[model samples]
Target: MAVTQQEIENRLWDAADELRVAMPEAQYSSVIFPLMFWKYLSDTWEHNHQTFLKENEALGLSAEEAHEVEYSTYQTFKIPFIHPGTVAERRASWSSILATVTQPGLGQRVRASLQAIETANPDKFSRLFGSMAWASEEVLSGEVLAAVMQAMDRTPKMHEGNMSHDVLGGAYEYLLKRFSDGSGTRAGQFFTPREVVELLVEILEPKSFESVYDPTCGSGGMLIASASLLKAHGGRGYTLKLYGQEAVPDTAGVARMNLFMHNLTQFKVEVGDTLKDPRFTKSDGSVKQFDVILANPPYSLKWKPWSNDPRALGGIAPQSSADWAFVQHMIASMDPKKGRAGVVLPHGVLFRGQEASIRRRVVNDDLLEAVISLPPNLFYNTSIPTVILVFRAPGTKVPDRQDGVLFVDASKNFIKAKNRNIITDANVSDIVAACHLKMDAGDESADPTEANSLSSRFVPTTEIAANEYDLNIGRYIKQAAAEQEDLGTLIDAYNIARAERQKTEQRMNALLAAAGIEGFDE
Candidate 1:
């Protein structure tokens, strides 16, 4: 009996939802997910230990012979079976055990195992785990914690070679979705709606063996999408390297547990301010470049002391909004050799002259790839319209594309769901297809009116330069073509409005007459 993806997702969400009854959505993610991850690891630990012992004994090896295999096989932080200290041996001392486990001195041992997982599971292992505040007396004393633990124990078992990664991954995604739905605007910070994520990944088409990175990887959804995209394209034989930087430790730890559950132990997601303190620096203390960069960074976040840092490659993102800073960082991290990137940005970033220098530099340098306007309500936080900007180094994968940028006016492309706009598979395909034709100048298709068709055209550098490098999609994509508009639509709208106005006027006249007051329309 195999667990379906839908089943796993629902079960995981149910568990998280139960815990939510006792705590805030945000607070309980820290509490419930770590407990769930712990249960998963413990189950995996027991299962592996039994298998390792059996295999070794059949080969005539002593019980000790299987210890290394037992401890070193999976890409998760290996918790010592016997507590290194008395605290681990007593269930009553769970709090103290957690304290000892997370202490700086003892934490090093955990980090060692983490590093090993990072090396072994490049796609899944690079996140922080067992680093939350779970051992606190508050979590230990609550019945909710007991419920959470029980829920976790019942969670289906998963492993590197087993169904755990996908099972737990689905659960994790479901929980994030539930959080976003419940917390509203606050949850928006870390969540890029799943449909939007799917669209981004579809357009980006991350390949196997390529390194993908997200500077603000909240909850690892984008990273997970990247991995999933590659896996879908083909099995994960190709080396996929993931690098992410997050400012929040708890969020970073959640990302780690996410990767661990998904069996992606090889990624390196660091916790630090991406702009102020970039943790992805190389040995020479410079930014390391990657093949593909996809990010939905906090839109228009501000940072103080607006003075320029040389690290700000795209020019300084305004202190009022760190959007440009993230842009610069993404550009910096991209390897000019084969670098490409796509970013979700506020519509303001397309034409706002407040950061003229940054915009000018990016467009003038011809790194601007494509700008696709998305429908409003696509995000949980804001109702403002958004866009995706694609970039590629000159003479890279698409050489002809280096001189021009693609503009896609997809603002009208979406499926309306209850309270939000969603980018369906069709929308994703439209956007991705438009992007793939990077060399075509705004005329990728002969007919723009065809449904399910991608209408994209390249914008010449000369035109871009003429507009002073404005990246607005409306500036390029012909939203309404000659045949798109019709006399029927115009006549119908005029007739309907005229009829409504006439009725309103007549009703108003009657009301005035009844009140013995005359009203005149000039």
Candidate 2:
């Protein structure tokens, strides 16, 4: 029987439990991700390697013949499964290292295998293992490492026969989410909530064969969501070209692992500072545009100001915040003919004094398309309100709406969570539908009233100019979320608050009990 996706996720999370005593919850990702990836490569290679031998066994092929087949037939295969060193040699592959769990210097053995695997497949696994040196006794204890391997070993076989790519990919996402939940604010560096990613991808609507890019692609969630959206629409997701750049080297590895888990081979996730040294650029040092671009970039990060870069179309952003700088880079990266972009930024960008000139230039050029004010507390990093700023190639759709920008005040459209708010599927649909009405007003016969809902409206650019180009939601939309809080919603909010309080009390009681004090009653 095939391994169910949920079962695989459960087992993986249990394996993560083995690391609780080994390191802090925030640091589990560095250890867990690499271990999971290693196991995947080893299991898949061993299964395929044996299958290749069996397929040719009718001719009574020898072991050497099978090794040749691994090269000649499976050369183009995504998994570069160079036969691992045997148990005696104690070299590359997960199984070889797992076998030495009882031996001394086990961590060193695991490190050697990782190095060997990277060395064997330079193109695919070049820096895929990343710079983390945690596979050592000095970092992660031998007993904990062994326990983790044993726990993972007991899970369903990771071969294609037992686990499909969808299940594998789902498991990877599950692990990412688990890591994110435990890591707190640090999680925002590599993980964006899936709903936020889905919202951005839906607005972009990337078609098959189109190129999609995320400049500050953390864990490649946005890129993965784009492919998933295509697949959901009965299209071939792997057909779309995916590109991204992550600042952290290990985080880039995680993104690469994520794309591969989804069986999306048509991707290139380079590691580097997107502003200082963008990896994907033309030979002339100009930004290479893509068909669709969306990102949830680092919020208001301080960086050395660069006034001379050609991508800085309007002017230099102050050293305080590089939010507009990322927007400028996206502008330079949008294709002149058919490109469109949606970026998640702090709402302050709508009227911040420092970025006023850049915002004014972008709006005057008719590049700004829509401003969506999302619910607060949607991100793990910060609770500050944010917006999705939509942009298009200057001439693509301005003639349709006579230079107008769509404003959506979805600030109150969310389902409450234990710690933060969540954008429900219904909310996402409502927001996306409103955004499309304005964009398709000229091309499609959109309802007149549909475009001017209580929560959203298409504002003329002149009105925005008169208001000093302040795209604040309160300025245009009469009511936020456009729906009164009902009794059911109020009840749900109360229940969520109660649940959070209960959890806090439980934690406090447990700590008190550990110190031999009386505990709180339920």
Candidate 3:
């Protein structure tokens, strides 16, 4: 009756493995994922098509005629209303079915089909069926392909119905994780680690009816996860207004599909470089703000340097690193009344002396709320230690937190995977809880055992200020390790004395040799 979450995840993983037969895992991911997506739309369309028939039955039209009208009414793709076997006397030859589905004209039909679905629920259905090039060798024939289709078909109907969002969404996320795991360094393009995303979402705690935005919203995982958080916290009464931007066309399409598959129809997810060619709109080309924002931008990516529009996040982020530019863009999008933002950045942003002006500007303006240093190998691509910077506009009231910043040293907490490190749920929850706590008295000190009072205790802003404003977590947060020095060792000094004594004797011999050559030396 209902497919368990584990079953669906297992089946999807098995189905995804089908592409491994013909292509490398990384290349096959593009081919396999899109097809799985196609099959999902195909199945859902079959269901919608049946419901349309029941409604049109009283009109006395033949099944085929009524199906046409129904497809038009719903803007759904017109696959033969019935399953190919059920609709035809016998299944058309496999080659013919392939040919029919792969015909160039079929692309238009598919697009139209997806477009109609979009009209019904613009946010959720608009772009779920992306363009399919079925004739490609990547999809033609193999045990893998066959097995994938069968596995997808085996997914319990319940996962596709009432519990669809949680079950299927998580399954797709699992697929993205698998793709990232397989793709290695290349995976950095879209997938962010789940633990890191959880830490950010927990800190932001986006509420229902609040708009959540990701400028570089790859695959919309951050958006989806935030929505999931809201759901988990009894936020169904509130709406998650989502907005996102991506530069890659294929990825943008995928992001749209991801939201649609989860039944999100009203959200606006657009395509374009958020830094140079922003797609989100404002009436006068001014800044736009959101209630909550989250992003994991490409580390140290360089943008076209010439266009320094202040709207481009204060124009011209450092030539070497675009961290602040992303920060500026995110800040611009924050809701003026109560905007809160969190971003993952390299530790360099906290205190590189080169951008002293910007550093002072951010800290002096007092917008920064917290910085959490993540462990090395936390990222799929690089081993560089990273940090999450939390920001909020001034004058906003937060429980137990009025001003200053929280620097969490989470760099030490993670489980090592083959290539990188990962934070388990326990780690994520603990970090989130600590963030909610009032800064412990002496929290800023190196020693964890220090205590403080209500009025006199809390993390000091002065320490962060002293580190030349570097925001690296190691600078503020301390790990427990005892350093010991050798109690008594004159090894280096004694070695110097021995060397001097030997040199003095050699000089004495040199004088004798100079006076009597070989004989004096002897």
Specify the highest-lDDT model's number: 2
lDDT of 2 by residue, 375-477 (tens): 8898877888799999998798646555878887777678889878998888788888877664432222223364333266777778888877766666665
Query: lDDT, candidate 1, residue 35?
Result: 58
Backbone clash count for every predicted candidate, in the order shown:
20, 0, 14
Q: After superposition, how far is residue 163 of candidate 2 from its true place, in Å?
A: 1.1
Give the TM-scores of the predictions, in the order they appear.
0.78, 0.87, 0.76
- Count steric clashes of candidate 1: 20
Which ten residues in a row are the worst by lDDT in model 3? 480-489
Error of 2 at 161 (Å): 0.6
User: Which 10-residue span in candidate 2 carries the lowest summed lDDT?
Assistant: 439-448
RMSD, candidate 3, Å: 10.5
Model 1, residue 358: distance off in Å is 1.7
Off by over 4 Å in 3: 55-163, 311-315, 397-403, 440-442, 445-467, 478-522
Residue 110 accuracy (lDDT) in model 1: 29
Error of 2 at 281 (Å): 0.8
Model 3 error, position 73 (Å) = 8.7
The lDDT of each candidate is 0.68, 0.81, 0.66
List the pairs of residues colliding in candidate 2: none
